[model samples]
Target: MSSDDPKGIAPPLVELPISTADRGFYDGFSRQVTIPAKIIVTLIILWAIFFPVSANETLSAANSTIISSFAGWYVYLVAALIAICAILAIFPQTGSLRIGYAGEKPEFSRLSWFAMLFGAGIGIGLLTYSTGEPLSHFSENPDIIRGAVQAQSWDAVRPAFVYTFLHWGFAAWGTYALVGLAIGYVAYRRDLPLTIRSALVPLFGKTMSGFGGHVVDVVAVVATILGVAVTMGLGVEQFVVGLSRVGLGDWLLNPDGSSSLPAIALALAILVGASTLSALSGVGKGIKWLSNLNLGLSFLLLLLFAIMGAGLFALKLLGQGIADYIGHFIPLSLTLFSDEGPVGEQLVAWQLDWSVFYWAWWIAFSPFVGMFIARISRGRTIREYIFGVVLVPSLVCFIWMTLLGGTAIALELNGSAGGTIVNATMADQLYATLAVILDPGTAFAVSGMIVVLLMTYLVTSTDSAILIVNTINGAGDTEGEHRKHILFWGAALAAVVGSMLVLGGIEAIRITMIIGALPFSFVVALMAISIVKAICYDLIRKHQGVPTTAVGVAADKK
Candidate 1:
């Protein structure tokens, strides 16, 4: 029962005595958050409060400038790195390696594992971008704009779908997989804490437990909070749009056509309340059920869109998009424009808005979604993890994007809705597309279903993010996660979203997302290196006829 006991139990490193002065506040979830992390989080909150718009403008400007300057190289490099990890995981030497011990089977069923990964990995992002991304690309992708008039016509539709898939497909999920593989291998296979810093143990060794590791974990916590907040804030905006689409009227819209404050408050209240309850219920029940429900509802919605919308056009577009995506994959993956040419400048501008933004968004998301997937992915092989986390989700997103986005583009091509679907706000595009395809009653019903689905997806994402942040801040105590921690994070998320709504609106959400992701991109690259280092070390030990298991490695070190 002592603090240093090694029977699968450990106690706190220090205990405090009652002070003479009584602040009388409870500390329910400070187990693993170092003093430095607490200070950083407090400072960030204070900064957001005191100078919200300035923070937004400063971060946004910095991010935009940075992304614009190095976008060509940064975007292609990340895409290449993710693809490399996926390729390496497919090799016979590494593919079959278990995430856990030699004979351990996966903790969750395949269905549950995939559901959770898909739910957490994409969540409302899939809903938000399915229509918006493709439409945006169709209207003015770099290639289309640079080409002749034909490229700007209906012919660009296929290319538009291709680019959208490029953003959401293998690269996106593969980014998540690389991070998860590193964390899962280190945590489950090597018996380290399930913190982001644990992925660096191979590189830093003992230093991972010192200042270096604390910085890594603190950066991860901050990234996860801001990343999830961005998603939540944007999702709430879309939720309000859905409300208006379903006859909730101008109550959800401001006089100036912005989202109403009262509407946002109500949306945050419901989202936070539901997410806290789900987080308290733990992953096995509440999160799992919601994820499954989300999947089912999403499929149903897709089916309706396929049948009621432009089915033939979407199918045609899907085929062409896949072919185009494959054909252009190499160029798209590696191409980075120089500043010397007009087209190059346009490409950089395009990338800063689309590709670079997405890369940062996904990188920011990796710490949370990657860790969440790794938690459910115990005992899976490297091959299974890579395929499940990367390829499968990419395909799902591709199909969803095709069905939703393809239908919208086809409507515009046919001159049915003209520029309305294309000109509508990003948050309103899906509802606008729905209006084109379905009758008023049907559109209202479908919008309602979407709202419900969005609600559940939001809750699933929020709760999972809460749990992931809790695990990191609680010193990676997965099994003994505190409910009070969930409550705290839920409230914190609501506050962040509410503050952004009041202060900088959508711009604040976007700015924080990119800024939070900037530091973590370096962390993920290091994680990839750490994974390679660990695997190489394992292979070397095996060749030398030394033990390579976690216990054996520890013994060798000792």
Candidate 2:
């Protein structure tokens, strides 16, 4: 009787609008975000106050385990596979490549859209690894973890690029496009919320009105947080490396990137604060402006690397790389050549190392890009969305890889840079390579710019990721969310990343990423299936002479 007649009881509700003037302000979402800004700032101060000076053996072991895991799933095989899929996605007639934006064309000019997506998406990875990865894959000793190879070998580069393309290519982009298309299709056509749950609208129908749907949304939010957290972790370390190489003084490396956590945390706080402000300004004013800045810097860096980086050396190696990329594109793409078969499990090892890891990474990274894409893609058609999301960005990556990576390889092979650059791996590769190609003053200037560029991107991604997580928390409130919610994620990210860094540095984080990426692969795979079904449903309704629009709207509401 008391339960039935409960007085002053609050009504149970589902979501709150993240916008400032909403009645449902700051339930799951925060508004205007200065509080979140301070939380991140606080973490930064704490980290700077407690910086470590050295890595323990356990930390070293954790790094080893993590990097080894990436090699097992992602190194070569998965990369090859992803690239093949991407190529297929690009060809329009393949019907298999169709997206939710199938019925219409893209709204923005193709080039600008591509520049935004690629800059926001793959730009972080390119800044540090573009040149180094290609070369490492070629060498026999190319960091394969357990295998005792000494150099990457000429044969390794082809498979490496092919695999890199595989992970970054169609499969990866498809995941993003598929999610975007589903939400965009429904939002543009069916009038659903632009959230991940909206993509599952067809499966649950009205049943999503319950806890099950809420759980689905929750999973997406967590994934988005971890994914962005890991990326920010990498971005921070690389930012430090680049700054030091360019002369930010001894504190940058400290021989133990993780030891100076307090300083690192402090720096990251400033970064997250600025980024949160940017996120509060909405995508156009903040994210878009920074993206364009990245593009300009990228253009300048490429030009400088090409002209001043020993032209003859780069030109020759790039020619070889072109042949390598082309000749092996298909074989590499399809090469599942596992350890159990004639082709050798070496490629399988590579897949575990890179492809699988990247796929997971992308899936984790998806919500941010998806949310960002959703912000930019309002007016475009289905076809336009597919091309812009998948095709344009891939080309930009390919060109950037060619110029930057090719130059590094060329320098190493010709002894122009004395093999100083490519000879190193991961973070070391970038710093050492710069030192080889550019004069001390010039290299320092260029490398320092790289650090700034990296910082801006790191901040941009964190801000976007924070906004996305907040958006998900607020049930897809596109208008913005609670400022406190923004800070929660920023601090959470800083803490999570700081913990991993303290435990094992980049190696620890990379392993965590690979582990994180695994389960999500299944999620994306399921999404792909759901999309295929949705498309087929559309075709089915049309074939039966039903009103396709009516069917789509019905499907959406369901």
The TM-scores, one per candidate, come to: 0.91, 0.78
- Give stretches of model 2 more than 4 Å off: 1-25, 28-108, 141-160, 256-259, 310-349, 423-425, 542-558
Stretches of candidate 1 off by over 4 Å are 1-35, 38-42, 70-73, 149-152, 551-558
Q: What local lDDT score does residue 77 receive in model 1, on the 0 to 100 scale? A: 57
Q: Could you list the CA RMSD of all candidates, in the order they appear?
A: 5.5, 8.4
| Model 2: worst 10 consecutive residues (lDDT sum) | 8-17
Highest lDDT: give the candidate number.
1
| lDDT (tens digit, per residue) of candidate 1 on 1-558 | 221335422211111111111222224334345344556656666677898767777767876676566566457657767766766677877887788877789999888888898778777988989898888888788767577434436877877888898898877888888888888887877677787888887877766766677678878888888888878987998998999888887889876656898999999999899999999998898999999999999999999988988888888888888888889987887777665765777766777777877787788888999899889999988888898787788888888998999888888888988788988888899999999888899899999999999999999999999888877765666776367657877887888788877777877766667777778888888898888877776665555555555665555557
Q: Give the Cα lDDT of each candidate.
A: 0.79, 0.60
What is the model-wide C-alpha lDDT for candidate 2?
0.60
Per-residue CA lDDT of model 2 for 296-405, tens digit only, reads 88888878877866455545554665566557656644444345644355655555556555666777777667766765676664555677677667666666666677
